[model samples]
Target: MIRDSYDVIVVGGGPGGAVSAWFAARGGASVLLLEKDRDIGIPVRCAEAIGQGGLQGILEPDPHFIAHEINSLRFIAPDGTRIDIQQTDEVGYMLNRRIFDQELGRKAASAGAQIITHAYVSGLIKNSDSIRGVKVRFPAAEKEIRAKIVIGADGVESRVGRWAGLRTFYAPKDLESCYQVVLGGITVDKNLISLYFGNEVAPGGYAWVFPKGDDIANVGIGVSAAMIDGINAKKHLDQFIERHFPKASILACVSGGVPSAKPFKKIHGSGIMLVGDAAAHASPLTGGGISNAIAAGRLAGEIAAKCIADGSWNEKDLSVYTRMWDKRWGDNQRRLYRLKETVFKLSDDVFNKAAAVLVSIPTEERSIKKIIATTLKNNPKILLELARTFF
Candidate 1:
């Protein structure tokens, strides 16, 4: 039963939206979660890889969504030299987003949120300076859904943030135009995640091969939009596929843009809050967003619900989420954004040399930290920057 209004309205049914709705409902708010897609996680985006510790405070990795457990990863340089890393702890997970996203939506519903698919939110229903609801185009009819707080968890092309007048623009250098394909019927190291780097491979970004099973992998590429003349992530990805998995069958493919930048100066307005990619929370260097999105989503949900309880869903109340995010991931991402500006511009030869340096380390002694220490030992400042970027 749809209601005229709710305590919180979460736009977009990605990880961020699900969690936001979940926490808000748990906090006793009437929550509504809307997904524009016909189904949750149908058109899978991203390479679908997340670090082991990435979900620490979120939720346990459910077997329903675990596609593969990664214990090792390989880095391929421009010259074709490979640097394989054996993680001492749990490395990461290759997610079956179809299942992952569905389960997240299920959790939100289980926590008392109302979930609706194919609900396309066209614009915000604003009341003076603050947002009061949304104008949505449902399959059957148009509707005006209201809420005390509206969370914009919509991805890169977030209309919610723009509608709220938040700064959502990104410089070309900070945007990664990405294209990914799931290749089947090919033999790959199922437990390993591979990264291919070189200008010839991905230009300003890198190509990734994340295994989903014994004979299938998500092969993809991300290139900086500024580094290229146009939106060419798909073209670069096509070339990489032809070279490496020529005989494999592409089961699925997707192309999109990922924004990576310092946390927005303002992610909240009078009655709206933006989380996930809407807030430019993806890693500036790697362009990964799952972990960061989940972290921010939780904060947004909790804070939004708190504001609803206090009867003050204003810009000031929502600013608590900003402060919390800044304390945790704000400084770190800002540092990475700075490093990305400097490192992502390095020449292919420099990347090759760095890869060689990493490969030179004995397998038993190899660690990402040691590799970074060895590669950037020449510059103490860069070394310090690298040391602080990981956590």
Candidate 2:
């Protein structure tokens, strides 16, 4: 049942929304978390990989949610040359997102937040220029749930941000159309994750093979939407699987849009705020957003509760979220955006040459920082640009 009012109402029950509700309720606010899907984590859309350090900081590591532990990553060139780098400092894990998301929601409910699944938010309730609440449609009834603060953690196709007057549209070049399938009966290196790069394999993006275990993996490809002339993501993925894992059995399939753009200039207006993909907070280069989403949601929730306590629920009061986010990840995202644009312009031959160069380096010295520096060595101007932005 929907409450008559709440101190905060968060839309979408992904990591961002769940964590936001968790923090908000922990801060003594009456929080309501809404999920359009009947289940919290059904229909996983992500590759479900997270750095060990980042995941540990968000929540205690649980064996129940971990599908595989990855200690190395291999990058393959168009010509089949591969550079393997062991994770001496940055290990990661493949997660069962379905279980992981539901656990997050459970934690939020334990913190005193109420969760309502299958509640579709149809629109924002506007009180003049400010967003007062959300209008939700349930299977049995429709209700307008009012709140002092409304957070839009509602993924890439979020209408809440648009309804609140935020510019949330992304350019075609700044979006990635992705498709993936869970494959069984295939033998992959259980301790290593693989990424393949080439126009033929995945135009303007990359294909990844994240091992779920010894016999199963999530193999997927992300193609730059603007570069997909007339082909679709699934066709590319199908061709890739046929060539790489011909004997693998397909178990499940998923497709979604990944935001490859920089975060919006404004994330808050009046009493409303945007987080996660709603604010386009994914990394421009890697298209990874899980770590950033959790962090953003937690920070936004804390700020929201504090604003309500202080009785200051205006744009000025909520602008702290923007500043905090920028200081934490937004600035880094801007730098990555520049690097992404520059790297995507490289020819296939250049990528092969870069891979060859990386392969020549000693395994111990093949840190990502060093590899990137060496790759751009011939382009002094681009190297200088990187130095100015990163250093």
Most lDDT-accurate candidate: 2
Candidate 1 per-residue lDDT over residues 110-206, each given as its tens digit:
9999999999999999977889999999998999988889999999889899888887888887788889988998999899989998888887789
Off by over 4 Å in 2: 378-391
Q: Candidate 2 on 4-123: residue-level lDDT in tens?
A: 999999999999899999999999899999999999998899999988866755688888888878999899999999998888888798899999999999999999999999999999
TM-scores for candidates 1 onward, in order: 0.95, 0.96
Give lDDT: candidate 2, residue 229.
79
TM-score of 1: 0.95
Report lDDT (CA) for all predictions.
0.87, 0.89
lDDT of 1: 0.87
Pairs of colliding residues, candidate 2: none
Clashing pairs in 1: none
Task: Please give the range of 10 consecutive residues that has the lowest summed lDDT in model 2.
Answer: 378-387
